[model samples]
Target: MNPMTIHVKQQKHDLALAPSRVVFYEQMQLVETFDDQSQCHMLFFYKQKYLTAVRTTRLKLHSYVACAFKEGTVYESPHPFLQALIETNIPLQKYSYPQLKKKIARPYSRQEQAKILTFFESFIPKKQLFQDMKSLFYQYRREGNMSAAYRVIRVMRDFAPNNRFVKEMANDLSYRKLANLYLEESQTLMERDPLFKEMCASFEDHQRLLEKEGRWIEAYTHQLSHISNQPTSESYQSYRASLSRHFDSDSRTYILEELSQAIPSFQPVTEDLFHNHVVNENVNAVARLYTERELNLNEEQFKQVEALLEENRFNETPENLLPFMKRITAQHPDQTRKLLDAFVIRLLETMELEQVHDFLKAFKKKSSLMRKVERMNEIHEDLDCMQELGELYYGFHQLEKSIECFQMEMELKPSAPEPLRWLSKVYADKKMLDESKAYQQLCVDVQKWA
Candidate 1:
């Protein structure tokens, strides 16, 4: 079945007037008549007087018709239909007709006033509108008309939810910001209103502004208080998680620095709050904090944090570690080296011996023995460092030292046929015939494999 088309007709003389009828017809046969009573009622209440006759004829009548007509000029007078309109309007407005009339009489409540103000709000210069609203709200506040002020605020909130003006009012008067107001008023609003949460989440900017004004404790306390109240709140949790992930390193460092000042003495519970609840599972901000304050941490506490990070395989990048190294080294050079070595050894211990050896070979400093060996190996014409050392020892007829060098060379490159052959020759020269035969047999075996 095709949906019925609605028709509407409006009176042209009065800008405040509405449609005459919303007609539904099939093939020009009037199947439905939504006459003037219903149509006029809808227009009056919605205050949509700009509607034309043609426009009105296109409307679909709804249950809101009575409520919409309650304030109409002819419709406002007492009649059975008007009484029904009042009754409907009252429940929808949550107030009596007299109260609504009184509200409408006020400058802010006038339909013309609202329309003029709204038009100016849209098309007038923003600064002018902002000033006008600011003055209006303040005047209402001074006159002890909080409702008027609130209405003005609502308009301002619509225009700029995160405006410094709105924030200042919320801060100074403890007026629940629009975001918090929506959240406090309705669970449905909290669930459905993304703008509300976004506005509130922008409090981080407010926090930073407070910090820049050197209100560290105040900023810290405010954020902590806000977070405490909303520990499990999704918006709050997501904000913190995003902060940890997206903030620049310096910003994160600054936040941690402020946090240290804010909570200098670690309460076990507060520490746990940071580790288990606040810090995201992916980013190790808590561990970074622990590392930053390691000097203040006892050995057991340090170990606990370290173990937790290790268990999770938390790898701090060089950018994170370098500053920490600089700081520790500046404080205690000797202790820092020892500490670093201990950590390095621990990391090495977790890997295979060959992997550890390979890591050391790659990482060894230019002056390091392994680096010297590597450089010498890279030169095609050069003997191994061990071979050169062995020759020096052999010049003194130190057979044991020479044998040790040959063994070291063999261990260093087991696949190298030259090292094995040299080892067999050394053993033979030492008059150790059995050792010579064994070394020669190993050389033959390695050659076959090669």
Candidate 2:
């Protein structure tokens, strides 16, 4: 594109001229003027529109009179041709046919002039051209216009490929906002377009690559984060399956590192596997590693690890469970439950029934009775864990403890009549008729509620 130079000329006319004077000298054609007069008027004549004309003036008196002719008739001007022409010494009268013919012999053709007008029209008459399109787009956007914006952008993108104004209009204010919008709208596009589906598949490929590298923890974390940012149940399931396949030996450092980077919460069954199978095997080794290197575990994580160590006796030689346990316990309580249950089961299985009972009794006695009761209440709400603990107590012939467990279970869930029935039987066995009658009545009441 070549640079365009525009020459501007302005003149002030003092006399009011009659319209009949304007003419085309070449064609001898008289020009028609509208009845309405405007302070500012611009006329564009090109070769395509008309032919060149020449004008000659033969002065008769000091007060000048001029004749003009184009394609048709010759006409006279009521006022003088020159008033006060500004910016140049060129006389306004010199703009007549004769002078115009002398200056430029050939003018633009009609087609050329039409093209120029069309180009100007493309941007001008702002309401008809740019205003409607711009207003429609912005109005659609203001209405949470995801689909509309997508359509508009797709269409307008071609109009202004390198235009900064268009780019700014299309670009999202922030990546996070862009991410969310894409997440919400991409699914629909992906369904409609194979190209979009391919893009999604590419992201999944990245997840697969991470898993293949034995970075199961990182892979899982990334998958979760991705899901949180852009939810898709199918993608989540695929990612989980991939993580499960890749997960092998527990590497606390690797898991922790990945957790820090990908998921700060860092509570996964994979982490527990690492803690129990890997870190527990060599407590000193794990502790030394933890202390020697930076541990990214937050305060909660540190507490979790400490609790795990205390409960599991990982501090013992050949199996330092302290750090791993601490880390696990510090995590979300729900996340820690499975590991805790497993640890408790293993601890009980290793010891004799009498020893386990004795330990439980002693531990219960040492801890605040109220706090222990609250903790029991918590466990009791979890039917599976509650049943496991109840059965354990029953195995030891701790009738009172067994009854207490059933009572707790009933308290936590009044809807389930089984616990009340069991409690009644326990009371009957102990010959506590009052308690038995009360539990039996409670069962009847619960059954009625059901």
Candidate 3:
């Protein structure tokens, strides 16, 4: 089979106005079209998609792999690279790069030098590609080839979607002959690029045309996506203002529903959704948000959650209310303790020792908390539970309560030495030297008997 020929066919007249078109032919038949001119490939059509066999030096034995490029992203099949070649129209099994040398062994042929040059230049670094695309964009603009200029800018936009200059270039192109092309490309790119999408929506022409065409949902989506991506106060205020200016109450509600759906992917959106739900005092939504994740709520939001917990106190479970209660502990100490009191009681009923200890250890021991742990003594009155509760109180520096628990445990099992040792430690912590010595001696006597 003859080698495939790849070349560009430039129009003879009006170089600035005409586009440079690249054509690929295998045995004198055109395969497919490519917008970017920098890619090296042996092109072919198979399975109703245009595929290119690109040279890859990364592979150990293989010279090339088949892949398809779309919108600046590469798509390669999961089939083994070798298997993809077998399915392709052209075979690239023998097209490997020559061994690289630091110094020339002999004068090389032109074909060998060209192959080496292409090999070295095949994989362009992302930063370098971005720079080259920007340079090409300016070159195309200087020649008044807006079609070619926009194509280069599109790739540039992909490289640096949030770049100010790239965005300006896009805006400049939107005013020229490529206005429709700019809008069309933006519509495609906006699906993936939030910053670019935000830029497109910011354009007056794009906004006016979109609304004029009864595509307000798309416009709303662009704004919502912008807020989701940015989530700054200014962006959110602008979104709210836009909603008030353009949308009715029903439309606003629908847009809010759309915003709520985006919560899982964009946490900032979740923050907004949570704010709205708290403002409306939607107990179920607020409760679900608590269960979803640990939210970083502000002071005002924490107050709102506190109010919600207070309002729903009659019906909600301690498990459902504890997270919000725990978060607002500093702001609403009384309310947090009240809910935690109930939560501790629930854990005691289940005898979930670890969970109960976690809650108790999280906060400083309040008078109400001591009363709550008394219920734990009421629930589990065995010698072991008494010894455990004694240590728990000792950890909180409640020395009197610790001694009380240790005395009760000693009464329940006079032979047990554990509570005697704990009583000694607790009394010493209270700076009661005489009591510490008494209990320490009792522990020694019990161990000696054993």
Higher-ranked by lDDT: 1 or 3: 3
Each model's lDDT comes to 0.44, 0.43, 0.51
What local lDDT score does residue 152 receive in model 1, on the 0 to 100 scale? 62
Best by TM-score: 3
Candidate 2 residue lDDT tens string, 245-281? 5443332333333333444333342344335433455
Q: Which residue pairs in candidate 1 collide? A: 7-57, 8-56, 8-57, 8-58, 10-53, 41-68, 41-69, 45-68
Tens digit of per-residue lDDT, candidate 3, span 211-261: 664444445544565565556667666776777665554445445645656
Can you give the TM-score per candidate against the true fold?
A: 0.27, 0.20, 0.34
lDDT of 1: 0.44
Per-residue lDDT, model 1, residue 182, is 59
Backbone clashes for every candidate come to: 8, 38, 0
Summarize candidate 1's per-residue lDDT along 1-450 as a digit string, tens digits.
Answer: 112222333233322222233211100101112343443222233221112111133332221222222321221121222222223333222222234334444633421232223332222345765675676678778988664465566656655578998767655554555446554755454433322333354567656655564433334335655554444446444434544543443444444344445555534323544444123442245535545555444455445544544454425442334344334445444434444444343433354324434544433232233343344334323345776655544543456766777788788889877767777777888899998898899989998998
Segments in model 3 whose C-alpha atoms lie over 4 Å from true places: 1-202, 229-235, 241-272, 280-303, 314-317, 320-323, 342-358, 374-379, 383-450
Error of 3 at 178 (Å): 10
lDDT: worst 10-residue window of model 2? 79-88
lDDT of 3 at 291: 55
Model 3 TM-score on a 0 to 1 scale:
0.34
How far is 411's C-alpha from truth in model 1 (Å)? 14
Q: For candidate 2, what's the RMSD?
A: 32.6
Q: Which structure is stronger by TM-score: 1 or 3?
A: 3
Error of 3 at 211 (Å): 1.5
